[model samples]
Target: MNTEAEVREEMGYSESNSHRLFSVEEYYTSYGKIPKLCKFLGNNIIILWLIVKANKDMHQLVYQKMDCPELLQEAVELLKETSGVGEDVSATIHDSKIKLNEICRVIKEVYEVVAKGICMLGKLCMHERFLSLKV
Candidate 1:
């Protein structure tokens, strides 16, 4: 597995915005409310893009890529492992799936905007670079 730092570095220079990962600790520190943390992180398009970018490199070449259903299942497993909780927590997580859906929706929409912005900037930069090339 690629280390988190490696992933972060690869993702950092891909766009103008500085991508920050949302840890549970950082979430509590910034928002203090676990319920709203996902929503907050969702709106940060750069970071959301980073999350998607991190997975971009995987499930290629030697193996089939994980589809969305597989990804969701993996995420649930990760949550169970990280939380170290049993059925009660599982029940809570089940109920909170709506939160996950909302966050995913926000992330997708924000990312589309960021992607368009980046493409526009890239075109401008390319034009600038070409003009400079002749100087």
Candidate 2:
């Protein structure tokens, strides 16, 4: 079994970085640790909300490239694994379930948005072609 300090070290959490606040991008780039970070923040409302806000800021720059379903699935898996629910029934199953459901809802919304974007892009392309033929 790994100690807490070892886990923190593996996750790129160090005393130096711990003393200073960092933006999401800076934290991610500095650590290069996504799964570990997600597990560390598992189901914490404030942290999750901050993550959502950061994601919204990043979405404008990378919306087309984002794979929401995969990301949500991975998050669920990480939360489950880290929450100790799988290893012991004493873990808070209800909380984990709630968080999982929330992630699924977000996944559904993401798919809906992606589908709408595809439809709009198709319409725009068709309109452009139609206008070109008349000229």
User: Per-prediction TM-score, please?
Assistant: 0.28, 0.29
lDDT per residue, candidate 2, 32-123, as tens digits? 45445556656334455566689768866322322457446545544544443333433324355546555555555544455445544544
Clashes of 1: 0
Tens-digit lDDT track of model 1 for 32-123: 33224334344444445555677666634233344567556655545544444343345446655646655555545544555555544544
Q: Tell me the whole-model lDDT of each prediction, alpha carbons only.
A: 0.46, 0.50
Off by over 4 Å in 1: 1-98
C-alpha root-mean-square deviation, each candidate = 18.1, 13.8
Once fitted onto the true fold, the runs of candidate 2 whose alpha carbons sit more than 4 angstroms away are 1-98
Best model per TM-score: 2
- For model 1, the local distance difference test gives 0.46
Task: Measure candidate 1: CA RMSD.
Answer: 18.1
